[model samples]
Each structure stands twice: as structure tokens, then as C-alpha cells.
Target: MSKVTGDAFNFSLLKRVMAYVKPYRATFVWSVLLTLLLAAIAPVRPMLVGFTLDQHILKGNYTGLVNITILMLVLLVFQTAFQYAHTLLTNKLGQSAIKDLRINVFNHITKLRLKFFDKTPIGQLITRTVSDLETIADIFSEGLIAMIGDLLQVIVITSIMFYMDWKLTLAVLVPMPLLIIATRIFQKAIKVAFQEVRVEVANLNTFLQEHISGIAIIQYFAREEQEYKKFEKINVRYRDANIRSNWYYSIFFPVVELISAMSLGLLIWYGSKTILNNPTIEPGIITTFIMFINMLFRPIRELADKFNTLQMGMVGAERVFKVLDTQEQTEDIGTLAPQKLTGNISFKHVWFSYDQDQEAAPKYVLKDISFEVASGQTVALVGATGAGKSSTINILNRFYEIQKGSIAIDGVAIKDYQLAYLRKNIATVLQDVFLFSDTIFNNITLNNPEISFDEVVDAAKKVGAHGFIERLPGGYHYNVMERGATLSAGQAQLISFIRALVYKPAILVLDEATSSVDTETELIIQNAIDKLMEDRTSIVIAHRLSTIQKADLIIVLDKGEIKEKGTHQQLLKLDGYYKRLYDLQFSSVGIAK
Candidate 1:
């Protein structure tokens, strides 16, 4: 198993990985010294027995035998103590290394821009952080330590055997070449099996997470049977991979055992012939030779087990490294603040496409257009479905970068400002409201933990959520379930509005924040928005033209460009896209202006 082939056993990877252990070098050294001590004592028992058989038992000297027995017992006690200490220190070192790695991985992941999450699946990321890290811990605690011990034991035992009787050692080693060849073959199979098992496990995890999260969707669509079939397919693949691994592992042991048994038989057959032919060969010497035979083969069996674990760990390492190596969407290491100017945003000669492959003659989700939202004013973006309205808002957040032209926040290029600093200043109320499974008060005061309960009550009242929250069983302490699933859509939207308003950010972006509520609730929120946008930069994306009629400016988007732009009254007079949208809406409402 030590002969693992191909890229899995890359020496460069191991050398690169050694740097992670530098912090715990002192602990590592102690572990190595303990391992060497343990291996050195492997042949002591046989030596003690030989001493007893020669100088005491054979000559009927019970006193010498008794003294030697007591010494051997003391040595055993010391060996056990050292073994326990070795495990404790190694475990401490391994856990510390894992903690450091987890911290680095999480910090890097959170620093990544929003676009990274859009492209990567949540399940894959979770697997790297949890399962993959556990595998690495296993490598350190079990595989790595065992491999070190086995190597030392093999070398030390071979040296002692050669010193005791070189001819006997050579005879015992006759079957070793065949054993090594078999191990080499088994190692390749083991690596392939373990790699497959790791991948299948990842797939199973991904499938489970996705299905569980979307179970309601499946039930709503009455596709439960279809989802079950899909899940079964993934589960079957996982089972097949496990079975394949078991097949490889089952063959591994028997082949190794057969070779070991054959080698021992040969050793016994050869050593006994020598003893029979030469009366000068002491019974004690023969007994020691047989004991050494047992010691020599133990390390070989352990080496195979350690190598199998190392191969499994390498498979997990490959998956984990994939995450650590991912390039973040936006990485502005420069510490630059936004420049001063009017809060006017413009898309100059702006052309954008979400897909890069179709860049040439790309389906412009947003076309070459120019528009501006003035400082301290509400700008409403109105468009039909698939008219690039959401994409436009996404670009404003820099969730996706524009391929052509540029987006400026407060008349300064978005790229110039640090992403963390930019996001900190912009507050958003998304169409799909998301709430953590926490108290309503906690969700409202997400960033401002120091915010007084009075402040939370004020924000909630502003958004008209305080009335319902106060009526709940536990008022502010009512525990929301995952995503606040128990709350009605309108209630969730109200909570989201309160969350965004409590932050009191410089820039506010609300996408259909009032869509879920009735006309009465909408009017209440409209009053709240009127107060909230008094001196703040606000952009509202709404389908109901009535909800945004009071905007300082309104831009109508078609495909990916601005088709019309003006104040609500001015756009109604254009008799263009905005007029058509307004007429269609009012016509549905059976109202005429």
C-alpha cells in the first residue's frame, strides 16, 4: 500500500503541506521521539525470554528468571505510558492545525464577492468546510502517525534481525519481494476505490441538501414521486461506490495475509532445519528467532493499513483544495474610499450580458444607454418581466460586473471602493425576503446590537410591523422558524422593510418591497418610505406603477437599456413604453385618468 501510484502520491504536495505543520514542530518532534522509543522496545520481550531460557530456565536458576521477569514487567509499564503520552500530544497538534485551517478557509470564503455564491452550489461549499476537514484530521491522527511509526519499526526490526543472524534474516526476506509487488497492485486499486467513494459521498450530500431545501416546492408542484426517483438515483450511486471500496479492501487483507503466512512458514521450516543439523544452536536462540519473525511481519501489516488511510485522505484533500484555490469574483486589495460628488449613477455607453461566451453579438440584457438618479431622491425602475430590471439592480449592487461601460455610485466608480465598505453603506430589501431562525428583535437589529429595544420598536412601528409582533405569543422574543416560514408573505416583507430601515444606510435599494402586502399595507409602507427617503439615495423597483408614481424620476427599461426616463408626470405624457405600462396597469384596475 506504500506504493500508491499516479498524481495522488505527489511529493511536491507533501512538501508544500509540510509548511502547515511548522507551528507545531516542537510537538511533532516529541511524537517522533516517542515513536522511535516504542519501536526500539519491540524486540525487548524476546531478548528477555531468551535470557531466561539460557541463563536461568535451562540451568534451573529460578532467582535470575524471577529478576528478569520483574524488569520486563516494568519495561511494559513504561512503554504503555509513553504510548499514551504520544497520542495525547499528537491529537492536540492535529486539532490545532485543523482549527487554524478552518479559520483561514472561512475567512477567505466570506471575503469573496457576491458573484462567487451565484456560481457555486451551497452544498459543495458546506462539504469542504465540514466533511473534508474531518478527513484531514483523520489523516493526521491515524494515517500520518501510523505511517511514521511503521517506517521506523520496519527499519529498526530489520537491523536487529540482521545483527542476530544475517543468514536467517535473508531466508525470512525471500517472500518480501512478492509481498511488495502485491501491495503495489492493491494500492492502486485502493486509491481508485477511495476516490470514487469520496466523490459519491459529496454527490449524496449535495443531493440531500438541494432536495431538502426545495421539498416544499416539490410538494407544491405535486412532483414528490419524481423527486424521490431522482434521490434514489444519487443514493444508488453512493451505495455502488461503497460496495466497490469494500471489494477492494476485502481482497487487500487476504492477499497480504497469505503472503505473510507463507513467509512465516518458510522461516520456521528453514530455522528448524538449522537447529536440527547443528546441536550447538541453543533452544533459546531458536525461540528468539521465532519471536523476531512475529515482530518483523507486524510492521508490514500496519504499513498497509496506514497507506490505505493516506490514500483516502488525499482524495478528500483534492476536494478541499478546489475550494481554497477558487478565485473570488472581485478582490480589491487596495484601500480606497468613494470620491465626493453628487449621488448620480450613470451607465455610459452601457452594454451588459450575463453570459460571456456570447459576448460578440451578445443578447444585450441591458443595451447601450444612459440615465441618472440625482442625489437624495427616489428613482423607480419599471419594466416588463425579463426586461433586465433585476439584472440592472444586481449590477447596482455589483453582484455581477458589467462587461461594457461602468456603474458609478455617488459619481465615483464602483470598482474604486472596497467591496466591504461599499456593501456596508448600501441597504437592500429583496423581493424574496429572507429571515434567520431568530427572535424578531434580533433580526431587526442585525448589525446594531447596541440598538436599544426602544429603537427596534420605533423601526418596527415605522414599517407597521410592531402591531402584529406585539400581538405574538412572546412579542419580540417569538422565535421565527427557518426563513420565517410560519409568517405570511406580507408579514415577512414588513419585517424585511424594518430590517432595511433600521440600518438607515446612505443608499437604499428596494425591489418590490410592498408587492406581498394589500393596498392598505402598501399605503402604510409608502408613508414609511416617504419618511425614509427624505434625505437618502433611494431606488425602487416595482411593477405597480401606482406604488412609484411619486418618484422624483422614473426609468423604463426594455431588454437591457433605458427606453424612457423622466418624472412620473413627464413619463405619462411621453405616450411611449412608460405610458403603455401605466395604461396596461390602470386598465386592469378599471381606472381612467
Candidate 2:
């Protein structure tokens, strides 16, 4: 917690960090004041000891010696107290500022568009938010202010040594150049080492996060040994970077100690000779010079390390600010917040591309796709993989913007509605149902206070999930564990259906929602969908053609374009893409139109 101010720092980044520090400026100011007090008091002790040895001890004035001893003890107590306050206040200031920063980082991350996440590694973001911020915390606790205090202490001690005996002080400082050279080399090496360590740590975090999440796939494919080898490589790189940083520390500290010992030896050797030749040079001054040299060298010994801490904080600040400055969040400029909508939907010649940033001709995923679904009808989308079936759903909910055309609901453009409002009204259940690690009830309600427990029960019963849920030990309160690990695939899918039902969305979307369920569970889900879509406009995507045979309309997509649209019987009669897809899906069961 020594003064940590002497190193090169990015003032621009420091200014940004100062914004968070503004709230705690008073505490910060107090901590600075304590650092100054500690620095001023640190040099006073040796001078007092020198004074006691000269006037009191040499004169054999026993009472004055006792008084001076008590006075020095009081000064020691004050220095210790000031140091305690300085440590407490600086650490408090750091944690308080970092807490606000962590909040802002999390908020920005949550608001960023999903597209940003697609390109970014989750582990890198994690490092920026958690590990980097912790390092930045050290900038305050062990860095800038403490560095300043050390610099001031060095100056004060050096000044006093010169005032007492300039020649001895000059002789002792002949070794300063060596320490400086060593410190500069150590600083440069350690800074690069720290950067490497940070990079390697981020890589390790990314590797671990992805591997752990996909551990099932790895094990199922029998690639554990290969994965372990890959992990070992990453782990070794991280270890090497840390070892390099530690090596610099190992070299630097011992060099400081050796140079300091040389300086002290020079001090004693010169001072003893000077006093032996000249009676005017006090023996007591030698003792004070010894104390001064040690005190002065202490901060010098540690200043380079503190400067590196500040530099790392700036580096960390740069990364965190970059995320905060990202402007790719989903646009929510629309002010309309309707309580409900009729869910009459229309897509007029819509086009979209996943790679919107490409300068080359954009590869459109959905090409001039147009469709309509009345307020109370179900429109099933039939297509092969990458045929733009789900792209329609993405555009409808505004997960991605279309390059052309418009999507409207109840004759109002979807973009005219507030983004959150539009999304809340359109509930989509994907093939991969994600449930949080929480009680089943919380997962269903998503911890919304407005949705009562009775509503959840009703939804679960409608989906035919209540029987199985109640049979569990804690029933609705059963802990699902992470990503619903404690629940079967069918059970998780059923819970998602119940969740969708309780929300009571105006427009329901089922994108292969029953793909994970067994035959019996799929049938139960089909019945649940029948009831759920009774009065709601619905869009369905399924590979199983039988599931959507009774839909009001079935739209077939091929290679990013709509090929046909009609009822099941009508599409079969057309003898086109829908007819072929339907035949292919049902041919395995010995049934085809």
C-alpha cells in the first residue's frame, strides 16, 4: 500500500477511470493525505534517534534519554496508525470504484447484440470483466498512490542525509546508477511478461469454458485424450508466461538487495573514515545516514513493480472501455408499448444476410421471402437445413434486421413497436430448450413476480407436465441444476412449453420444439400446441411433416427463396418442393402422398 505514483501511465484511460473514482474522491483524498503523512513521519524517526544518541546518550543525561525514547515511541505509534488508515482507505476506494465499474461492464455486456457475442469469445469477455478488473484494483491498492508516497519518502530521506553529511551520502549513492539500470531492465521485461500472461490466461479461460460446455460431445465422440492434449498445451503456455514474470521478480529483488548492501557498505566505510579524521563529523550522524539510506532505498527497490501495476491497470481499462463503447446493441428506438396485438403478420419481399459486414455481394440467408398468417391461424414453415425457415422467425422478432422489405403485425410495422414489447408478445421455443440452474418454478416463471404460481401449474397441466413434476420430491420447486442437467430432454422441453404457455404470447413460434422429445412426449406436446394456438397466431417449423399436416398454411422454402405455399393437401397436389419434402419425411414410415 506504499505510494504508487512514479511510473508511466495513460492519462486518457486514467481520466476515464477517474469517472468511477469521482464518487469516492473524498476517501481517495483522505488516503492521499495519509500517504503524505506517513512519508513525512517515516524520516523523522532516525533523526530523533540520532538526536537522542548525540545530546542525551553522549551527555549521559538519563532523564532526557528516557524522554526522547518515549517521544520516538509516540512517533512510531502515529506512523503505524497513519499507515493503517492509508491501507484501509485506499483499498476501500479501489473496491468501491471497481464495483461500480464491474456493474457497468455487466450492464453493457447484457445489452450488447447477440451478433457481438457470435464473434467474441465468452472467456475473453469473462477475463475483461473479472480477472482484468481485479488487476486494475491493484492499481489503487498497491499502485499509484503508494508509488507517490515511496517517491516522496526517498526524496525526504535523501535530503536529510545530504543536510547531515553530504560527502557520505554522495559516496553511498555511487551504486544508484546500477540499481536504476537493473530496475529499468526488470520493468520492461516484466511488463511484456505480464501481457503474455494475460493473453495466455484469456486463452486458457476460453479453452476451458468451451470444452467444459461441450464435455458431453467430447466424451461421446471419444476425443477425451485429444482434448486433454490440447488442454495441456494451453495450460503449459499459461504456466510458462507466469514463470517468466516470476523470473523477472526473482532477478530484480535480489539485485536490489545486493546493490543496497553495497551502498550501505560504502556508507559505513566512508563515514567511519571521515569521522576518524575530523572531530567535527559526529559519530551519531553515521547512524542517521544508515537509517536514511535504508528508508530511501526501500521505495526505490519497489517503485518499478508498482509502476507495472499501474500500466496493467491501464491495459485492463482499455479492454473494458472497448466493450463499454460498443454500439451494436439491438436498436430499441421505437416508443410504442402496446398492451396487446392481433398478431396478423405479413412479410413483404424480406431479405437478410448473416454476414452484414461483408463488402462483397452479401450472401443472403432469406431472399425476398413473403408470407402472411392471420390472427388466429397456424402457418407451418417447411424447409431443409439452411433453407431460411428459422431466419423468418429471427427477422419477425427483430433478432436481426432485414436488408430489404418490411414485417408488419396488425398492419403496423414490427419496428414501430418497442423492441422489448415486440419480443415479449412473440414467444419462440427453440429446439434447444435452455433452463437456468434454479427451481423448476423459477425457471418457468423466470422469477417474474407478476406471474403467479397458479398460472404455472395451469400451464404445466395444459402441457401434461404437471403429473411428472409433482411426482418429483419437491415437485415445482425441484432444482433443475445447471442448464437443466437434472431433468430429461423431454422434461426440459415440456418445462419450456409450459413456460411459453404461461407467458401467453400473442404470437407463438415453435422451431422444432418437439425435436428432442420421444414419440409419446411429442404427441403430448402436439396436443398442448393445439390448445396453445387455439386463439393465437402461430408459426411452426418441423421436420416431421405429420405434425403440421393440419396447419392453415404450409410454406416451403428452398435455397433462401420461397418455392410454394398452401395447405397440406394443396401442396401435395402441386407435386413440388413441399410435396417432395413431405414424401421424403414420411417415406421412412411407408407413407407418402
Candidate 3:
């Protein structure tokens, strides 16, 4: 968010932006040719006017005047045609390039590790993908190609001016230095303002996205007025940033107009004296010079604004490339893409930390944790909040890498197997279920071609969800809406269970999956889970001791380290951490332990 003071006409960033244009180079080349044609044809009009005035108009030659007029009309037609084609080509090329860039950004984001998402805001990423990249499209359509055309027009106009009469051209050029100084100062000030504007835009997007998504909480807490004031603060900053940038434009444009007027006055004063003193200098030359001044100053005036457009484009490019350049992706270098895996998992003296800075003294969330689950075995993780229960499941699924030791499935290192293959074989059912704004069937199969509709129905039936699902309006095709808002919490949990069931994963990880349901729903889920555990190696994280009483092994954790490990009866006999937890839970619920 720091103000960018560097040169806005950044070549390196420009080059990166052009790499996407390689596929559309043919259109780019055609656009450039048209631009050149328009520039070459521009000065011809004024020259023809001067020619007709001096050669035909002055002598009263009607036939010659008619011929010159016809030629001028033809030139105008060609210029218009070239302009139309140039605009079409540049716009076409701009859209095609940005489409590819947008896809690339989306692809990159999908592959990024969960750790990156844990730290970055979703809103900032949305701005980079949608709005910021949209600004870059202007670089091709309105900024780069258009600026080139304007610059060539200015150069050609200036050349023609000096060719006709060098002294008059020199007189007209006297005011340009002042304008140049003003332009430089304006560019510096505007770049800073534009950066501020961009920063505020991101902030506003983040605020709106967050508040809207959590509007229920805000309303429930009765914080609408407070939230509105916060939004007002951000909106005010956005307004001020835009106004500041506009203020720069307002001042700079008037100064340019004034400089243009001064050049016109200088031209008329000098030309009038010369025409009076010297009879050889024709009136037509003054008229042509006037047109040249207009031609020259118009582009010069527009060039500043277009330069601003180009700068805004570059600013967007800088932000986008920053996302593209991030290397925080989980390196899927393992070539082994195994088709099937046994339900055996092992963690050997594993150490992990979410803190990415290795140089600093690392704060590990899981310390020297070691465990094992054989094929068709059920292991439950029991702990209070922040005791690294979820961390265990996350690391087992390779969502985050461990700092020390190795994780393996069926004696093969987890990293040695392909990332997609490993993840597909391990299904996770989180406590808070997340369903897409899609049909029930799509959410169940997740669009997996291998899983047929029959398979979805069978999976749902096994989880006791088919009866309720068929009772709904659309049955399996019913729209769950966003995050399953159309369904009850227990219904959503059942759907998630069905989702995991169809995957037929070798390893199943449930993070407090049954802790949020009513007694009847829990009984239904527990029965389904019992059937599921007969084949798959299940890892369950739960605070409820009763739900995991039948697990083959319960590993109790406190402050990240293993405090106790045994079966329910064996741990009770030990009179240790597990028995204390069991007592505490039963006491809270008025059950005599």
C-alpha cells in the first residue's frame, strides 16, 4: 500500500504484460501499420490546403481547385477507414490477451497452498483477478497504441511546420518548455495519487466483501450503525483519493490549454509582422501554420492524459505480476501416481509450524507428534481448543508441510506419491460443512465423471440421507444454495458424509464432524460411520468423548504434546488425562460417570 514514486513508464513491467500478447502479434502488427498510415496521411491534408490556396485559389483556376478538392476528400476517406480498422484490431488484441492472463491467474490461484490462503484476504485476490486486470486491458486498447499514434502525429506535425518555415516553427515552440515542466510535475504528483487511489479501491473491496458475507453476524450483534460508520470511513477515503487524482488533471489540462493559446498568440504576432513586412510570405502559409499548431498541441495535450492512462495500466500490472510471481505453491514433484492405496497411515516424530519464517524462533503448533493407524483401524484425537487436533488432520492430508520427520501411507512417503493422488485417497469431513451453490447431485459427486448418479444415490442411502433427499422437491437435483443455506445443519452434515463416502477414500479424517448435530442425527451419523470404519482407516478429531468411546485407540493431546494414549476402558483404569476429560464431559452434561 506504500505510495509508488518510481517511473510509471516502467519498461520491465511493460515487457511482462507484452508476453501475453505474443499470441496476438498479428493483430498488433496490423494495428501498428494502420497507426503509421494514419500518421503519414495526417500532414498531407494541411499541405494540400496550403497547396490549393497558393496554387489554385490565388490564381482563380476553377479546374485545378476542383481536382485538389477531390484529392483532399479521398485522403480524408482513407484516414477515416484506417482509424476504424486500427481501433478494431487493438481492441480485439486487448481482449484476447487479457482473457488468457485472467485464466492464468485463476489457474495459479487454484494450485496455491492453503497456507497462502490462510494469510491473504480473499477480497484482495478478487480485485487482482477482476478489477486490476481489467485496468491492464486499457493498456492495449487506449493507452499504448493510442499514445504511439499521438506521438507520431506530433512528430510529423512538427516536422512539417519546420519544413514550411523554420522561423515560425521556432516561434511556436517557445511555450513548449513551460508545458513540459508542468507535465513532468503533474505526472509525479498524479502517480502518487493514483497509487493511493488503487490502495483505497482494494480496501473498499475488502470491506464490502467481508461485511456482506458476514452480514448475518453484524445484524445479529446489532452492529449495523457501527459497521455503517466504518464503511463510511473507507468510502470517504476512496472519494478523496479519486478527487485528488482528478484535481491534478484539472490543473494540468488548463495549463496545457493556456500554453497552447500562448503558442497561437506567438504564431499570429510573428506571422502577422512577417506577412506585412515581406510580400513573398503567402497568407496560405499562415493558415497552414495555424492548422499545424492545432494538430501539434492537440496530441501533446491528449498525450499527457493518455500517459496517465498508461501509468494507471502499469500500476495494475505491477500488482498482478506480484501475484503471478509468488512461489508459495505446493511442489507436486512426486511422479508416482498410484492408482490404489492401502488404509495405513504413519506420522514419525513430525514437527510443524504455520509460521513461515524459519529464521525466527519457530512456534510449532504440533511438537514431536508420532502416531500410527493400521488398515481398517480407527484412531481418535481428543483435546481442548488449540491443542493441535485439526493440525494433525491437516498435516496428514499434506495441506501444510511438516518441518521435521516423515509422513507415509502404506510405507510410501506421502510426498513421494502425487499430490492429487494422495489427496483423492484421503477424504476430510470438517465440522462446518461447505457446499457449493450447485445441485445436490453435483455436490455429492463433485462432478467426478467416474461417480455415476446411481453411485450418488447408493452413497446417500448408505448414510440414511436418501430418504430425506428424495422427500425434497427436486430430490437429488435440489439446489443446496450457497454453503447449503437451503438445508438444515444436520442435513448439510449428512450430505458431507455422503460426499466423503462416495470418494471411497483409503484414509478418512473427520474434524469434529458429529459434534454439531442433534442426538438423533448423531446416532444416524455414528451408525453410518461404524459401517464406514470396517474398511477405511479413520482419523477422528472430537471434543465429545462419548462419540469416540468405541475407537480402537484414543490419543489425548494437551498443549500440542501427547499426554495419554489408550482404549476408553484402559485409559479410565490409568486414572490419567483421558479419565479426567471423560469426567469433565459427563459432569457438564449431568451424567454420572
lDDT of 3 by residue, 407-510 (tens): 88899888888898888888999999999999999998999999999889998888988999999998999999998999999999999999999998998988
lDDT by residue for model 1 over 20-40, one digit each (tens)? 678999988888888888888
Question: Could you tell me how far off, in angstroms, the CA of residue 292 lies in candidate 1 after the best superposition?
Answer: 3.3
Off by over 4 Å in 2: 1-8, 590-593
lDDT of 2 at 390: 85
Clashing pairs in 3: none
What lDDT, from 0 to 1, does candidate 1 have?
0.78
Alpha carbon deviation, residue 481, candidate 2 (Å):
0.5
Q: After superposition, how far is residue 235 of candidate 2 from its true place, in Å?
A: 1.0
lDDT against the true structure, per candidate, is 0.78, 0.88, 0.88
Clashing residue pairs in all predictions, respectively, total 3, 14, 0
* lDDT of model 3 at position 276: 95
Please state the error at residue 406 of candidate 3 in Å: 1.6
